[model samples]
Target chain A: MTGAGNSALLSIRHLRKEYRPGQPVLKDISLDIDARGLTAIIGPSGTGKSTLIRCINRLVDPTAGEMLFEGRDLAKLAGAELRAARRRIGMVFQEYNLVERLSVIENVLTGRLGYVPAWRAFLRKFPAADVARAFDLIDAVGLDESFATRRADKLSGGQRQRVGIARALMQAPALILADEPTSSLDPKTSVEIMELMAKMGAERGVPIIVNIHNVELARRYASRIIGMTGGEVVYDGPPEGLADAHLKHIYGGEEFL
Target chain B: MNAAAREWTRFTPGERIARAMLYIVTAIAVVWSIRTIDIIPEFLYDAPEQTADLFRRMWPFDWAFYPKAVHSALIETFHIATLGTILAIVLALPLSFLAARNFTSNPILNLIAQFIFVSSRSVNSLIWALLFVAIFGPGALSGVLSIAFRSIGFVGKLFGEALEEAQQGPIEALTAAGAPRSMLLVKGYWPQVEPAFWSVALLRWDINIRESAVLGLVGAGGIGVALDAALNNLYWDQVGLILAVIFCVVVVTEIVTSTIRSRII
Candidate 1:
């Protein structure tokens, strides 16, 4: 059913995921993502925050539900259709996940793998335009041209995360999913990373969905916040509306607060 | 303060008895093995004298024979090793992917690939040479085939292990980016395993050189053919010369391959 004024880029209805047969990680989750704002999914460890983000990208397949993006159900897509859909959704991992032996530029170039021919990607012969765009994106991510030729393993954690961000943006994706994008970084670097993500999301008009454990950082950067506990959403509202009572309910203890 | 702090070093009676029994059992096994193998003290005492007489005959090695016979046989040995290593690596590359757990999750394919590796590895190179010699009627072709077949298992097993141990993070990232299977292999997996692949190939080549040198004893071709002839004709000096050549070749191959491996890896 085509809609007149629906701005939702992604619509999830009754999404569920279970790694084990009887125990579910995500239980009947539903949400709608607009086209241009940062949404943070905040929760304690062992919750389904990461699972919900991964389900959108199909990195972790759903047990049951509908994930509608670009007018197609992501959960039902398979093979070539799944791949074609995946290319439009960029994912940033907790570990940054840059190929360690590859140079920074090569890692970023991998983002264009879906668009480039397989043989060309194998030989690492990216088109001139893609190379130019990669350099531009690297610069946008606050990394210089010299860092582009350096191998990924040689870079520090923060620098590698910057490369991760550049690589994700190079896909020119419609949506970006970051699973604990700043969890491994120090507090200062975490703030910088969150700011960079927020600015990039605004500039590119792409919705950013991040699964984070840091509540303060989430409140500081997230335009909209989704609080979850025990594999179900406990609260969903703007960051300003997240009260201490909601935090106590979501985290299940007052001492940490 | 607490009952004079019981001593930790003292062993219980049962532990002490078990330790004594372990030593007694080891000693008995060693003596039994010596008797079973018939390692006579008399033969051991006579070995030095016999070795001295053999060395006296082998002195003044046939330096004049190096140009015509020894040189060509040595060249043939090198050729056989090179060809065999190349063939083995070409065959092992695809088989390694099939054997890797991450690549081939299908249990039947993994078992089949693992079986090929086990079968090839279980047969010694000399036995492979003997079988090939019978089939091909004694030539360098037999030596080459034998080396290749024997090496396939070793290369495949090591390379497959390297693939399995590669970091999963990059593979997941590539998959999420919608990269196909080939792209995931080349861009995601190949870079991580490149050093291991090179190291294994060089190590296998070094081993093949030594194996090929001895293949000619079975009439499969190489310097071993010269050695076999010298032994049959009772040419002690020529036998010494052939051995010296083999020694030099092996030492040089070891040095060269190690240098390359260190530089690359």
Candidate 2:
């Protein structure tokens, strides 16, 4: 829950996610994400960093928690309510996760799926406004205009991540959650992606909660850093404030970190 | 990579003797089985004269029978295959959902579906035709049931496997997008499975056309009746003519199916 002031756009309280009994993947983790900036969640493998971000959208159901987004408790929501909450929060994935067979533009339009009726979505009949916005998003993402007609599978990895960003942008979301969105890219490409993400988040004043492994990149781009270890929130602060001691604690060793 | 192990080794005396004895026994068994089955030859001894006798007796085909023979029988054959395929595709689509591990995941449901499909597929179309002939009694209905039963099993098994390996990314995205369960099947699942479905369905259509032709042996109506009748009367020429027609039918069906399938993909 947010503090008495409730300044955050999304609030988490006592969150726990357990895939099996007595084997908690996320244990009693909680944080508040205020609107208007980028927040990076940094953690090593198996720390439930991805699970925390996915939980707000209920992608991976939390075993127990209070996740409040926009005045509604997401953890308590179900069915339509959960979907409606999710629509406001866009997500990008490590693999880009664009429907490979679909065109880049079509994938962008998929962000509008929450707004469109099921029939419209089923028939690929997005509203004209949605289509126009999709084209605009395609243009905004630095893709060639004609590339909108190309299938996602044909794009290079960097281009696909660009499309992934565009698809998230298409949602016009107040909040964005990215799960290791750069892990698949080259180091150079990963920075370019981080730059794009930061630029987009800054331009829209949308708080993006990103789960990333690249601590240096996260330090460079993120306004706030959230480090998790062993399913617990270990360190939550500004990037410069997180020390080598914390990195060792979060990753559990110097070599891996 | 070992030199000694990789070298070509000669057989030991005992091994050679065992091999000789095994070969002798196999040859004897094969000959006995063939003789018991009446496939071994008095005809081999009189091969030249017997061939001549058969070909001569297999006379000028009764071409007058062609016009009457094709009337209801051939049309009904196509109808049976068409309707059977249609019904099987319809039935198999849902059964595939139950059978797909990603979709149902219920072990009991999956196992039951497998049992149903396997049992249906285990019997040959002729056996199905024979069984249905007993029930539906010597008509196109028997042929339809036979084809439908066999196709249901085949289409279900193949399509279920396709559903398993289909790109999980889209499915994951769809669920994350908050698509309903029914929406998952119709919108997300169907699109992914469409290409596999169309290609296989067309291939099955080709096979079913040939299966329909053979179903007539058990009085499930088609070219098989004519073929069977021609053989019963010692009309080898007419039997040969029927085989030629069947060959033509199969070739044309294959061409048509492939052309349509190419367009679909």
Candidate 3:
């Protein structure tokens, strides 16, 4: 296990989250994420996988924890400070979560909302460089130039996920968090998405923390794998070390295996 | 139980008894209310004769009255509705944000906004006209103010509901992208609700036109004053002309509005 050394990009200590007063979803958890490469968190449904990623971004507030990122405690920030922290962290969702009524280019430009002024965003007058970069990122994610002007609702599931990836990359973020980014796609598209994510992470040198349900995809794409159950990390090692016993421990059944 | 032998057509004993009781209660209430209101079936016998007589008196409409009394008043009615709807939209824009659960989040502000919508909607537009007439005195000012106040509740209520029913997925995405509240409102929410907002605005304008036409009955201004005068003086021909102009205006407005709506949405 990586300790809270100088090389760690983010260091979390004894993190805990509870929606209700007493019933905690994430128990006291601790981990250190490096600065580059893909790390996959695999677990069953309703096991606090989404909650853990949301907590890192402060989308779900931590009941008790210390999340140190860029020399500040993320769990303790509020208002502008919290927003500033969030700007550096890009998030992708299980659903594409694109603004359906907005054009593809406009959705991509929304990633710069934190840096741009409100009036500019309202008028859609992003800076020239931002616009140029948006087009570039759209291309980077395998979308053609014509797709930029189309409404998001008109795209296929795979195409929308490609847009989702472009939108997240537009932020120029320090870290990326993907909550089931490929769950809605077919097997072929899912593999393509995972490959694109892996390639993007490698080229950009930004670490990606992905919460996924498919163990095979995680093994194929991730450098490291963290197996979780009941809000606790049951297994943490290289993806090759994740075997049938670890899967049994994480899923609590051998019928499917 | 066999796969196909069980009964599927009959209600249980409790359900049958409850349904029978409901029918009996409804029947009793209807009879009691009818008796209490003291409606006489005999009075309806003369309705057709009275309607025919009124129609006969109103024939040969006074076309000359249009340029003098009806035209300017008709224009004033249009002005009242347009200005009133614009003002209501301006006021309702923020009020709806306050009323929406996803937007406001504070219970107290939500309650206040909802209370304002309910109270404004509870009063009839004529009652609002009456109140404004007392306060602002007669003429187009009172009519405009009355229409604005009456429409605020309708526009605000529907706009708030639209905001509430908007897809949460994009909002979550925006929040995750570190958008400010204002940005969330404009980029995240505004695009989703734009069509609904325009539709409501057009529908309210249509309603206000019809409403403003009647405002002059209480001296609040518009063509209603001409209508009241024609009725009082027993100039049935002028009244017929005024009604015809109003009908034409309303039908044209509806056609124009529906066309715009279809094109935009």
Candidate 4:
């Protein structure tokens, strides 16, 4: 695979996003992600980490960018092409954005919505294999079968995040992007969630890219760490190379370090 | 500068003058309206006596008329309200999605949906009943059409607002998963707005029931036709019985809707 020269699963180049004119959130971001292990992106609030992740799935359109994922230019894809590309990328949210009124099983099944016919989804008549896979995924994400029938709103923060993971994995995605998946969880739950994600990524052999606020958690769980500051990546290395000097540079303060 | 010596008034001098002027204008307007409205002094003086005499004639209602006309008319009224509400729901559901800015994101479509709602709401049900009666002829069909048309605005506007108010988080997640627009609507938006949809439907149904009860006044059909006939014939006893029945049905519908709304919400 390395002999092909361009072996990156996702290659982002000159990705720029600005919500308002002249006030860019992501400034000329360029990176290549290989197809394995967990990569954690650590940055302070409002540093464009979430925006960066969102741009990959085209949830937040980039002002200007080139994101080559699989074989398509993600930035140029529109309509059906955009949707087809999105189905390959699983996304976990900070809020565990499961449909609050839907049952857990339904939420997981929604991960297969891109593949299922619209009418079947409307009638809640997902294929039997997809249903079985969803059930297995629910169990794999650390939730028992009992959780499948419960409403998502009834789950605690931790449990909800687990469902979120299962929902993402249900897509059988080529890549997984988690945008602060552990931020809403308690400290212990945060660790567990991160561990679960890392384990899941390894098991499925899918590269996981996570945007995280906690530096320690990133260092602990990430195979590769990319530190960003002011919409620019300041440090890109293994966890051991992320020293206090790099931390000060990335966060723009020495006292916090 | 003593803090205690500082003075404060609810309104400034300009505001006080403005308020005083408003009151004077309101008083003058009321007086003008009262003077403009033609009220005969003799009728005004005998109002209490006329009311008492009418009440005296209305008592011991013609209960014998219950099975003959009022019962079937009452049932027809209920049917008009229920069917009208169901039809309105069916017609307004798609329009509501279009009207919701978050859902459609097209200004022109939103404007068209909103325009339909406003036109539907601008005319009262009675006025709509008149129009429909002209088109469909005086019957329950006219009443149903009037109720459905009038209610589309109310149900569409409120349910559109509910759709707009739905959390964008789950929708974003669904979008990221590459779900098609229809899937997002059915799986994402529908679940969030389902309760509000039912609540709005029930509320509109309740109001439609009351409105349909009076469509017969315009020859559009229902219990109102029987009530109108009794009033035209000067059968005060039958009128009293019809009014009493309407009151009981309205009260019962109110209770039923509130109970269902509470459970759904």
Question: B206, model 3: CA deviation in Å?
Answer: 1.2
The segments of candidate 4 whose C-alpha lies over 4 angstroms from its true place after superposition are A1-4, B1-24, B38-45
All candidates: TM-score of chain A: 0.97, 0.96, 0.97, 0.97
Score each candidate by Cα lDDT.
0.92, 0.84, 0.92, 0.94
As for model 3, its CA RMSD to the true structure in angstroms is: 2.3
* Docking quality band of candidate 1, CAPRI definitions: high
Clash pairs (backbone) in predicted model 4: none
Docking class of 4: high
DockQ of 2: 0.38
Please give, for residues B1-265, the per-residue lDDT of candidate 4 as tens digits: 6875597788989999999999999999999999999999999999999999998999999999999999999999999999999999999999999999999999999999999999999999999999999998999999999999999999999999999999999999899999999999999999999999989999999999999999999998899999999999999999999999999999999999999999987
lDDT score for residue A171 of model 3? 85
Backbone atom clashes (below 3 Å) for every candidate: 0, 0, 0, 0
Interface RMSD for each predicted structure:
0.6, 2.1, 0.7, 0.5
Kindly indicate the candidate among 2 and 4 with the higher TM-score: 4
| Residue A194 alpha-carbon offset, candidate 4, angstroms | 0.6
Find the candidate with the highest DockQ and give its number. Answer: 4
Encode model 1's per-residue lDDT on B32-147: one tens digit a residue.
99889987889899999989988888898999878868999999999999999999999999999999999889988999989999999999989999999999989999999999
Residue lDDT tens for model 4, A93-197:
999999999999999999998888999999999999999999999999999999999999999999999999999999999999999999988999999999999
Pairs that clash in candidate 3: none
TM-score of candidate 3 against the unseen true structure: 0.96
Clashing pairs in 2: none
